[model samples]
Structures are given as structure tokens and as C-alpha cells.
Target: MINYISDHLKNNPLLVLDGAMATELEKHDIDTDSELWSAIALINNPEAIKEVHESYFKAGAKVATTNTYQANVEKFQQFGLNEAEAKKLIIKAVQLAQAAKAEFKADDLLVAGSIGPYGAYLADGSEYRGDYDLTITEFMDFHRQRMQLLNQANVDLFAFETQPNFEETKALAKLLKTEFPQKTAWMSFSIKDSQTLCDGTPLNEAVKYFNDDQQIAAIGVNCTKLENIEDTIVNIKKVTNKPIVVYPNNGDIYDPKTKTWQANPKTSSFKELVPKWIDAGASLIGGCCRTTPADIKEIAEFT
Candidate 1:
């Protein structure tokens, strides 16, 4: 699978797939907030999780991330659990992916452990960056446990996505380089503008931070509009030659009628912008919120 992802990156430049979506699963009648949603949900019903994986696999995904992004210690603490519970959750999510890979004979499906930010995202730009008891040391300790579980799961890669803050993202990178030295790690910084991460660091500066790390396989953007991805990749290209990946949100993120978070409409239609992303040097591509298997199918067939 590693070779497959590596080879695809060599040829296509944009190996696209669907982005990680929790609420979308909930809309499909799965529990988006299940205790297992972070980990156990996949373990409890590998078949159910397999269904999602197969959907994307058939949709032409080169990578399938285990639904472990929210399975972090801090998030489990919100559910009144401790670090041990969080570790178990992460293990379960990994196990479920392992099962699905074998069942579908998806030898080429790269299983990436989805690692989201430790803080909440506010639409108005007010994230939970508290000046309180939990110092960066404490927070990095929490991330270390998650990384351990992902390493133990033997995932092909670690994907730190939706990381709004540069401080937190840098902290995770430091931990991976020191603790999980054997595993490949990638990063996707969410954007507030075409050129800057949500915390306002320019993409070029962010690229400089990860450029020297050999463990980083690919680095790019996720959870932004497709229309903005070409510009982001082009900007990132100015800094490093690392393989670039993008998982853009399906257009129309905010919907008043349904109050949907990632409204799954085919905003900008896949055919139009996918080639643009490829031409701009994107090495990996996929959908985020509101993206479905069909959208992935469109990308695979068209791209």
C-alpha cells in the first residue's frame, strides 16, 4: 500500500479520495457522536465501518483513514473518560480498518490515522486556546498517547488535519519525530484564507517548519473549499517539493435550511477543478465534509 500511494503520487500528482466526515455518517443513520465513533464504533461493527471504507475504495480512494481523529484523549475526557479509554478507542478504530482492508482485499488502500486538532473550531475565529491549567506540556502528553496507538496500529501514515493553530501543529510534529520515528506523518492545515492557516500563519512559513523532516511524506491543505485548493497548493509549491495532498470540503459548507455543517452538494463540480488541482501540483486529493462516495467516483472517473 505504501508503494501504491508512493507510485500514485509519482504519476497523478493528485491521488484524491473522500475526506473524513463524522456528521455525514450521522446523516446516513450512523451515530456521529457514538462513544465508539472515535474508536469503538468501528470495532463494534467492522462491517459497518467496512461499508464506508469500501464505498470510498470503490470510489477510487488511494487512502482510507481510520475514523480516529476525534478519538483523542482530550475529546474522550469531554465524555468523562481517561487516557486509557482514549487509547482503547484508538486501537479499536485501527483494528476496524485492518479488518476492512483484508476483507475487501484492498491491498493498495493506504490506512491513515486521522488526527484532528485538540481544540474546538469556532466559526467566528474563537477557538479554545485557553490560558489555563493544561500547559503545552500537558497537551503534548495527550497527543503522545494517540500517536503511540496509531504506531501500534501500524497505520501507513499519520494525518494531522484541521489543525488551526501553528503552536499545536508544531507540537504534534515534534512529538512524531521524537516518539514515533518509524512512522510516516503528514499534515493538512485548515485555512482561513487562501494563503494562511486558520491561526494566520502563512503556508510558506508552515512549509518551512516541516521541510527538513524526513518522516513527513506529504503536506498540504484540507477542509477548505475546492475553489481555493489550487491556490493553496500553488502557494505551498513555492516552499517545498514534498508531495502535496488536498481534501477539500464540498462546496456550500453552510446551509440555512438544513443547518448542515458540510452540505454535500457538488459545489464547483468535480470535473471542473480537479484537473486544476492536478495541474497545480496536488499529489493527493479527496473530499472532506459533505463529500460522498459518488463524489469520489466522479473524481476517479474524471481525473
Candidate 2:
């Protein structure tokens, strides 16, 4: 399956990934205010999640990421779900995405199971700063179970996304190689600037760390500002020959306190910036926070 996606990426100029799932679900009037974010919709509004995926598919997305970004056991337990129940929800997240792909009838479409940062479980904006004190072993322990469940659920690959620190990124790469050597995944970081991750680690240094790892099929950035993306991609390309994957936010600031995005009036035109990303050597291009199917449709037409 990994090879199939790789071949497709090689043949196509760009592989279009789906835009934001939680943001799209919000458009359907489904409540996503719980700590689980989009994963909460899995239990209450599974069909809505599937519809969002279908919408992206119709908009020409070849990849649909599962709504498992916050579906880990820790977050589930906060909602009073036991370990068994949590596992069920996690598996169901993948199942919902798979059903969407089948209904959309896009034979080439792929599912990338989402593995969000440990700080996402905290829900305190720590994901953007990487200020947590969790050990590498603790990070591995937190991620391993979820990765196992997502892998068993038959996803094409994992999207170990929004990593903010160099330690967590390295730990995830190690876990992927040591535990699930046959499975392929993309490791995308959250950046504070064009040159550094959220934790202030140089992006080039972080990219060099995972450049040779076979299990990490691609390395790039996500959930970052539009202005920072091109330099981030160029920095990653400088160190690694691996494919670069970029999905940036819509140039809006996320307010964790208000749980809303304050739109930037000067947001770059998706139509204008997507070609710059591709020209900068981005193999995968899509949206993150506040991006919609209409934005994706424009990207599809442009590509």
C-alpha cells in the first residue's frame, strides 16, 4: 500500500490530501467542543465525518485522513470511556474513513490514520510549544497502543503529525522502525518559524535526524503559518532526499482559550500559494486549520 501511494505520487504532479475534518464537521452543525475534538463526532455523528470525507473526495482529494487525531485512550478516559471502549472508538474512526473512501468510489484514494501529538491530548496549546516534560519512553508508551490499533484497522499508512519537538519526532521514528517496521508513515512538524520547530529546534537539524530512516517515508510541516511554509519546505529539502509533505493553516491564529480561529485579513490566496509550494518541491499539498472543500477544489483545479 505504501509503495502504491509512492508510485502514485511519482506519477502525479501532486497528490491532493483532504482538508480539515473538524472544521468541515463544524459546517454540519455537529458539536465538536469536547476534549476529543473530531473524535467526538465518531460516536455521535459518524455519518457526518464520512460526509466530510466524501466532500473532500469530490473536491479531488486522493487522501482522506481518519478522524483519530485525538482518539487516544487518555482523551477517551476523560470522557468516561474505559480502555476497551476507547479502542473501539479508535478503530471506528478508521472504519468511518474507509467507508467514506468506498462510498466516494475513488479507487486510487488512500487513508492516512492520524497520530497527533501528546500535547493534543493535554489540550492546553502545548502541542504548539512542545514544552511538556514527558520522557521518550512515556511518549512511546502513549503512542504505541494507538499506532497498533490504527495499523490493525487497515489504514494505508500513519500520519504522525503536528510533532512540535525534536525529541518526540525522534521517538516516533524509533517507535515506527522498532515496532512496526513494515508500516510506512509521514512525520510532519509544527513550526514556530520558517527555520525552527515549535520547540525552537532548527528544522534542518530535525530533518537530518530522520532523513535516513526508511520507515519515515516523508518529512515536512503542517499546522503552521502560510508565510512560513515555503522556507520550511526548502529547509527540509536541503537535508533529505525524501518526499516533502506540506499542509499549512489558512494564515489564521488559533485561540485555544476561545477555541476559535481569528482570520488573518492578509491570508495568502490558496490558488496563488499552492503552485509556490509545488515549485518548492512539495510532493503532497493540502490544508490544515480553517481550510475547506472549496479551498481544496481550487487547489485541485490549479494542480
Show pairs that collide, candidate 2. Answer: none
Over the stretch 1-303, how does candidate 1's per-residue lDDT look in tens digits?
Answer: 243456666656467655455644654466554433424354344456666776777777777888876567656666677767766767777776767667667545678888776653112222222112345565578578777888888888888887767777778888877777777777888777678877777878988899887777788887777788988889999999888888887786654244346545556876678888888888678888767887788778754
Residue 264 Cα positional deviation in candidate 1, in Å, after optimal superposition: 8.3
Assess candidate 2 and give its lDDT.
Answer: 0.86
**Models, CA RMSD each:** 3.8, 1.4
For candidate 1, the lDDT comes to 0.70
Model 2, runs deviating above 4 Å: none
Q: Write the per-residue lDDT of candidate 2 for residues 179-287, one digit (tens) a residue.
A: 8877889899988998888998988999898878877888899998888888888888888988899998888888867778887898887898988888888988889
lDDT of 2 at 156: 90
Candidate 1 residues lying further than 4 Å off, grouped into runs, are: 1-8, 11-13, 33-46, 77-86, 120-136, 255-259, 262-266
